[model samples]
Target: MKELSTLCYIEKDGKYLMLHRTVKGNDVNRDKWIGVGGHFEKNESPEECLLREVKEETGYTLTSWQYRGIVTFVYGEDTIEYMFLFTADGFEGTQISCDEGELEWVEKAAIYDLNLWEGDKIFLRLLEENHPFFSLKLVYDTDDVLQYAALDGKRLWL
Candidate 1:
């Protein structure tokens, strides 16, 4: 079944809020560090999902954010996910512990040191480059290795 999700990189100072997905036993992101997000709930738009997820996971109400892009992930053969990507620089609230895993404010320059998916690196670069709103498609093999990638309908070299 196709899935819809939202991901947000909440920025503060020179760091981004990162989630270490180690709590879920069967999580596809287990042991990997990623931005805050989750699968969409019924009837939730991208913005709604983003807001709800950020609050539930971080106890923050976003006051300023930008829609960064859309990512289409083709996982092996059975699962396809459309994820809305966002970046937020303004929010209000105190931090809270997440049941999903550890949350940390990772320095931008050190984000590469974290265990992350290859496909994630691709999009992270796009975010770093401050690319305009884009559409990225990432195709992965059964082993979770990136096999193909395209940006805005054009194939990317890596």
Candidate 2:
């Protein structure tokens, strides 16, 4: 299992900083507007991963962030990714476009308009509600359909 982590940076104005990626490789979330982050290196914690990834991709030094949720990524027969999701509200420095994609500040009210994965949509909504969500384990079947999901051992917010 490959452990991956990501961070969602929210500005004081209720706008979220996101990355627009192109589908030129085998990345599962390629060609999507998603958070800026990557896999964790050895001996690095989730916080370290988010801070480093944000700085590397957007040239920002992150400060305030909260652990929002976790997701299990199932890709084909030989790949499984354990992902940790985080939300940040403060950072320093200017944003810059990275080789991964362009960077943009998206309003909180308009996040649903972007091309996001179904799982992302769910937790993004949860984050907006200011609720405390511990974890969400989603299972994607062979056909890529989210056949089952156990959220905090109960049904997720409907």
Report the C-alpha lDDT of model 1 over 9-84, residue by residue, as the tens digit. Answer: 9999989999999899998899999999898999999999999999999999999999999999999879999999
Angstrom error of the Cα, residue 48, model 2: value is: 0.8
Strongest candidate by TM-score: 1
Error of 1 at 8 (Å): 0.4
Model 2 regions more than 4 Å off: 155-158
- Residues 6-105, candidate 2, lDDT per residue (tens digit)? 6565566878988888834866667778888888888888888888888999898887888877877666666678787888888989877688888888
TM-score of model 2 relative to the true fold? 0.88
Clashing pairs in 1: none
Error of 2 at 36 (Å): 1.1
Best by lDDT: 1
- Worst ten in a row by lDDT for model 1: 116-125
The TM-scores of all predictions, comma-separated, are: 0.98, 0.88
